[model samples]
Target: MTTEEKVARRKLSLLELAKDLQNVSKACKVMGYSRQQFYEIRRNYQTFGSEGLVDKLPGPRGPHPNRVSEEIETAILEHSLAFPTHGPVRVAQELALRGIQVSSTGVRGVWGRHDLLTRHERLLRLERAMREQKIELTEEQVRHLERFSPEFRERHIEVHHTGELVAVDTFFVGTLKGVGKVYLQSVIDCFSRYAWGRLYTSKLPITAVHVLNNDVLPFFEAHNAKVSTVLSDNGREFCGRKDQHPYELFLQLEEIEHRTTKVRRPQSNGFVERLHRTLLDEHFRIQGRTKWYEALEEMQQDLNDYLVTYNTKRPHQGRNMKGSTPYAVFKKGLPKATKKEPRKTAENTA
Candidate 1:
């Protein structure tokens, strides 16, 4: 097929899925095209028909096409080294501030040629160059190397029952007059998604341990179940390599395994992170009066009420527990316990 026809067919398929799903984000994710790219493709198809769908190759027609100068290229590399976290847009802005003329697209082209697609990738190359003495280092890059913590950084898993895995995360829930800055520590079973949370003034390891000790463990223990593993980020509160990391110690004492998300990969803990976002929208935002809370006790009470309704009443739309509340699913997964008393029988069988 001609390039135009091939491109047209692809665009038609994307448009059809977009129509079917009625969700730009989901459709774009499935088709591997960004939302902006999809919208542009749709617009071109609607306006110019199939002819507009043809992909255009880059570069000038003349022998002397526009090219980045050696000076400009050097500047780009130096800026990248200095601000390893900056992307093409920010780099272009920085260049403009330094009286250099370059479009974001041009900066991106330079980055692509260098294979510096992300800040993390740039940081790696910058470090290797410094080690090999390949490139001269700037003061800013040197300082950043000293300050950056690389450890600050998965999804397919089937959970058949509660207590197989639980995710715990701390969320900033704004400040209160008596409580100062408030934080919510949430623990959710990966299977049933039954959640428990407590508000606290500190994010210390003890606070997290408290949530597990007083809340999660007791509830599960009452049902004769035990938490197999807990998933969280590398935050010191969740876990660390230190010998005295209280959170890690607590998990060990409870015979629960601790698993952390990969560095820079929060989507690995998608379940808990999504819960935080939903709480931010529904509970925190709605109850926030003038962005300040009245009292800690009252706030905690409100949150507890919400949690009760969420666990016992609200039907979950999660993949496994469709049309079932979290509590309903949790009970089903509970290990069957034999009756304490044997059945009584009459002795007069004669």
Candidate 2:
């Protein structure tokens, strides 16, 4: 059956053979055992029943004697729970500074015993600990969780309809030969992913305001919709004194709320980030290699053409898009109570 069972059967057979032959020396020779081994087997079987016949590894048993004390083990676990991203060497060094002398190998051994040898395992332990206890997380711990946890990343701005919330950002399109550097002022509706962008030589507040005033708001107006909130990062172009900053003043004048994302957390404004990626992959990279542009107008014209196709022609497979164009989703997403007859296009207007 099992290795232990096989060994027990062999031992029992040796005893039985010794009885049947009535000769201990002959039985020992036949069973490949010394006379001393035969007596030891018989003594074990007689004393402890069958379990004593099973093989047991010879060791001191339980935790190794040289393992760090419980106090040091608790400190190592607490430090790991606080900063799950730290490696064993760093953990050991930190403990050393605190007068808790523990080698990296010792730290690793403790982690192994506790099933927390990997960074992910430590993070999971921290998350479970937070769920089970009423511990207030520090800012560093919050940032660490957000950095590595996909569930944290998935928590994003909620928008119900088109024009409810919009995201704006500045992107550095490569430098021109004559012009020093080209920057793109990009904006996108958070709900439908309808994007608008304009290239400029600088990323100033005026440039940010100009894109909203000229392209973004006009498109919303044409669709009989109004943007309620504008989300941007804590960049100079978007955030400053409410009375002095051009972007702030523009939002105030238009009666739209200006919301800035958490500092250094770009995923909060993921709509604009995804838009920039699409522009880079589908438009800029392809256009840069195909044509040599001398002026900003040429690049702008090409960008406009691509945008038109992106809004009205390209089938978007984003969340809830259902293979519809961005413009179609933008139109359909408007609340029925707020829906009005959209302004005529150039074809209809003409």
Per-model TM-score, in order, reads 0.51, 0.56
For residues 52-99, could you state the per-residue lDDT of candidate 2 as single tens digits?
A: 677677976687789999999999999999999999999999999999
TM-score of 2: 0.56
Q: For model 1, how many clashes?
A: 3
lDDT of 1 by residue, 1-350 (tens): 98767777887888899999999889989988899999899898888887778777677654335667878978998899888898888999999999999988878777888898778889998888778876776998876664464532133556877789999988888767665898899999988989999999889998998888888987987777778899999987987764588898777766678898777777778888878887777787887854445778778888898889889999889877888999999999875663432211223322
Runs of candidate 2 exceeding 4 Å displacement: 1-150, 337-350
Clashing pairs in 1: 153-262, 153-263, 153-264
Of the candidates shown, which would achieve the greatest lDDT relative to the real structure?
Answer: 2
